[model samples]
Target: MATLEIKDLHVSVVSEDAPKEILKGVDLTIKAGETHAIMGPNGSGKSTLSYAIAGHPKYTITSGTVTLDGEDVLEMSVDERARAGLFLAMQYPVEVPGVSMSNFLRTAATAVRGEAPNLRHWVKEVKGAMADLDIDPAFAERSVNEGFSGGEKKRHEILQLGLLQPKIAILDETDSGLDVDALRVVSEGVNRYKASGEVGVMLITHYTRILKYIQPDFVHVFANGRIVESGGRELADVLESEGYVKYTGSKEAAALS
Candidate 1:
């Protein structure tokens, strides 16, 4: 139903001193009901793409355009992007020390939906979502991601994904630092969201382990600030068997090859 189009996007950031470009004329498109996985090496600009799309101030788009359903995305503020149906599951979810989970969720849903969710129904929804995510009832009383473990933080991110139900979900390293059990649980939550057939997913990850749980319709290989290759699920399997040596000529990968 919705289409996210990226046309020749170029992004830059301040690294210590001068401005350094991270994304180089990146062009991609994702429609509702499609899942795209972006895989790449450490410094290959994977996170940069997500941040730029999410309208983070750190990454500046010096060229090109991003549109959601043919509407300009770059012109909107970060919060406006969310209301425009964009969701980003960050690699490192920050801690909001004073905000309780329930209030935070309610406030966010209120803003994104343009009106406050009814108290009674919202409570039921939050409880149901938490139960499905295996979160304790008492957990909602705690501050958001405050002192939570790495796996807990990741689960919390997936929890938001299930609740907010954005059009385009950009998950950056959702599998990082998760145990086998945690990975499966989070992946299932993502699967449930994608199953709706109305959400376009842009999942960015380094390993293929999560792919086994959440299948991607398309896999894109990012290298040196650009997409080097794009293919089907078989591309990820290929990467698992043969590392990124083909796209990246790093000594570490060559030794493995």
Candidate 2:
């Protein structure tokens, strides 16, 4: 089974001409067939963890070891990570103004698969995945997220997840900006992808609503840039009722209480 491991990860990004540390000694392990939910307050480094793992140029890994199936991940390029079965669904999906979704998906698939998918079969594959996600067929020809609504962009992210079939998926705030129906559709899509039980999922979000659709094997609480608590599904229920006040210990969190 594939495994992604992070040990004592420390990450920083330049802010105001200074490198501000975000992820402080984050250690986690994700093996195939497990779903781990990372819940945290804003600015607690949830997205930073995703970005750092995906090798986003902005965040600097000060010290840590990230390995995929025991191979060093920190040494790989962004595209290399994807080919190595690491996938990240960004909190804010970016728009590719001139690239058609169909072409982009196929190109990405080719890159990851190390060969071009059969065109006839590839069309059927994308169509089926899009249909499962309730995405309109018209979207396949549109510029990637150019004029898509927030929910549409999110569905496209899941579309990529299904087509790429990565070993480990890091979804950062995928539930954000989704409506009730959109959330269900997106969650169902994720559930379908993980049904094979061969993919490890790291789902990051602040709310427990998404958990209602996609059940997690483990629930971890993020605070002050690291995991503070972890438990079974019931942990999500606790976070739902109590909020993050206990974990964050911030006036803002207390006010929400």
Candidate 3:
């Protein structure tokens, strides 16, 4: 089991003159076997925080540090970070033409596990994971995420999670585009990944619907790039009832009320 720690972390997107600030001095801690949910209005830098932690090249860390299990993650390259037991499920999964799902999963697993997985065992694992998600084994022959629906992409991300078995999983908006059934399947995948008791999950989402399937250990409200409030799973229910209106302080929300 490992813990992900971020301290006074700041992030900015590159530009000509100066970097545009996105994450403004955010701090968070996630322990193994625990699920932390980050909820916020759009453009509140919730996704930026995940990308920065995963070391996305486009987001520069202006200051502070991110550590995993007491190791300095800020110093490691993205691939190194993955090998060090970190996985980020992207909001927009990219299609890599010509890369079969099996090939991609094998290559990524080899990279993340730092060794080639046992072929027989690996194949069985893949089949079981797909079965659990109700995905056809035939889908493995298709190119990675090519022509995949929104829900399929989300399920594929969870498939990677099951295969990789990272110590910490950061799911960035995995529920964003999923329909009801897909959302349930994806959430189930997440639950299965947690069954090992060796993995921790940090989930980011605007909607509280997914929370019904994947109960959170903690729920945080992010505003202006920082977490303004945090509580137990019930906070998710509050967000669903009232929306982000209280957190965002938007005039439109006030007017609607």
Q: Each candidate's TM vs. the true structure?
A: 0.96, 0.96, 0.95
Q: Which candidate comes out best when scored by lDDT?
A: 2
lDDT of 2 by residue, 1-257 (tens): 99999999999998777898888899899999999999999878899999999999999999989999999999999999999999999888999988999999999999999999999999999999999999999998999999899999999999999999999999999999999999999999999989956999999999999999999999999987888899999999999999988886754453232
User: lDDT of model 1 at residue 143?
Assistant: 97
* CA lDDT scores, all candidates in order: 0.91, 0.93, 0.90
Q: Scored by Cα lDDT, where does model 3 land?
A: 0.90
Order the candidates by lDDT, highest first.
2, 1, 3
- Point out the worst 10-residue segment of candidate 1 by lDDT: 248-257
Better by lDDT, candidate 2 or 1: 2
lDDT score of residue 37 within candidate 2: 100
Candidate 3 matches the true fold with a TM-score of 0.95
The window of 10 residues in a row where model 3 has the poorest summed lDDT is 248-257
Flag regions of model 2 displaced more than 4 Å.
251-257
Task: Tell me the tens digit of each residue's lDDT in model 1 across 137-228.
Answer: 88798999999999988989999998888999999999999999999999999999998669899999999999999999999998888888
